[model samples]
Target: MSDLNARVVIIGAGHAGGTLAALLRQYGHTGPITMVGDEPIAPYQRPPLSKAWLKGEADADSLALKPLEFYAGANIDFRPSVKAVKLERSARRVHLSDGSELGYDFLVIATGARAIALPIPGADLQGVLSLRTAADAEALKAQVGPGKKLAVVGGGYIGLEVAASGRALGAEVVVLEREARLLARVACETLSTFFRDVHEQHGVTFELGASVTGFEGANGHITGVSLADGRIVPCDAAVVGVGVIPNDELAVDSGLETARGVVVDLEARTADPHVFAIGDVAHRPMPIYGRMFRMESVPNALEQAKQAACAITGRPAPAGEVPWQWSDQYDLKLQIAGYAFDVDEIVVRGDPKSGKFAVFHLKGDQLQSVEAINAPPEFMMGRQLIGNRKALDKAKLADPTVSMKEVTA
Candidate 1:
């Protein structure tokens, strides 16, 4: 089949899947494109679901990835409220939940991740929620507002962002974390301290190193959380943001190689050349880090979408971008570039007290990664340095007076 005329089938109508279909069309793919999503609505932005949408600052129309009319106008067949139940790899066919089948010239599995549910008791209570979809956000939004109390389990980005939003809506917010510090798994100690202080100043309570034993409820509604420390945190509602598990059952059932996610290469091609995986469902090569990781971020999704589109449309593979992610809590914007693996030193630029600083992670003077808070220059320059594998003088980098360019020199 000609590259542009090949039929494409994409599963999972999240950010990555939706973006891939759009990118394929932009790359001059005139083939038949069909997308199957379990959600009744089309693909929409998920990041905002925990923040603006939860706080009533963003509406459904504003969060949509693209208008419903765009799909029809682009001649893309978007099947919402349908599930891809089975993947017939040998025959390049997919069995759907609606008693239908689809044959594809190329199969793109973009199935994203799902929120990990709390295993404790009372988890099935009426007011306990986890934010992963628009429906989840709406449910959470309705319960968190003035005169309400919200108990958050976990201190990761999602948990912290939700706490911030809950606080903004005048809801009493208490974050319960088993770790001694917030963002223990993903950020440096200094950055963690800064965020913890910020949240605390905003009147959000923190229960660090607190183990949750179970939840207490009455009449099918959660009322409080039982902690190992012999304390009961009272709340009207609760949100659990422990982490996410990739939706890779179809790949596993179809005999595709799998690990933490469906294993794919830089081009997003699985063991089967005709099959490709992208977004949160893909555990692909990270050349810069010299490893494989299932990156759950918008940038990773967009990059992998381009990678898959280029390969399918006969275009040259695009240059690899440094893996980056961002989070917003209150007025702060945290932008991170690259991974801080095996770091030997960390340098802080600017003042955390002034609400502006960048944390630089270095391995023997080489730029490994950067965590910048409200500091765009540091983020941009540090990202470029990381991509180039540049080394720097620690003193110059730490000096607030030194320009980012001069620090490199």
Candidate 2:
């Protein structure tokens, strides 16, 4: 186990895989590290695809996790545009699409997830797109311009972010959501309302309670979206941001356990001790939440990568931290820390109309989570309180005159 010359193979050169490779080297692992990915490019940041990149504020090179030379200098063999066709667990080898096999002493599955394609008709039209990769963002960007009609399906973070970006590019955006509210899955009603209003103020239209049945098009390009109510929202292009499916087929084929994602223990180890799963493709144990959950965020990927590296190098796992997520929409910055499901009470501080506020979710007096909008101080303090599971008085926490330190103390 102490041998540093062991071969470590990582599937999917994504945030998790790429980060793990760098961390392994940092932790004094002198082994041969190879990262295989289906994409032709190196690991890149995905968050900016719908925000900065689509708005033309950032370029492809800026999205990369590390410079190209970093991988070579660190002796990390990064194989791009190569699909992992099969995983031979018995031989501890991975069969790739290019008719090659890679042997490994340790394997990490960071294949990540893909955008869920709509099963509806006309989804294959030219102008219909989903944002998941660098290429996807580039394609979607071409469709955003002044006077362009862009219809966004679904009301999730991806959909909303793209809508905001489209609006910023002077495109006419209409968001179609089956639910009556925006961000219904993740945010509370108050936070959702705030975002909905903010987007509306930015001239982004929302068609709540609208279900898309199919897309309408001519000459192989999307022209409009047909709703279940027999109405069509005309658009020149459409972006589907419904959700994503974890790329766990290789794990399943290799006889590894799979649920919503590949199931992994606290140390990111899979059913096979030599194999580990991280990032969006891992349903890892969340001890604080008393359950296994998959977090699709940069912080989650980096933290899990560190854990996997430590485990591989015979080091103890890092201390647990509360899960956090953030989103950028025009001028608004939304930051959320911890899970807020099934909270007994919700408290609010600051003024949403003033473009700054924090919504605190509490199970009785215990601080469960915080959704802060342009409120950096609240986010910082709230994250600490959630990590410590500190209970605070609702009155004091909601009072702007009372400082966060006083409330936490």
CA shift of 258, model 1, Å: 1.1
Q: lDDT tens string, model 1, 188-263? A: 8998899999999999999999999889999999999999988899999999998999999999999999998999
Question: What's model 2's lDDT at 329?
Answer: 90
- lDDT (0 to 1) per candidate: 0.93, 0.91
Writing each residue's lDDT as its tens digit, candidate 2 over 147-262 gives 89999999999999999999989999999999999989988999889989989999999999999999999999999999999999999999998889999999998889999899
Best by lDDT: 1
Error of 1 at 6 (Å): 1.0
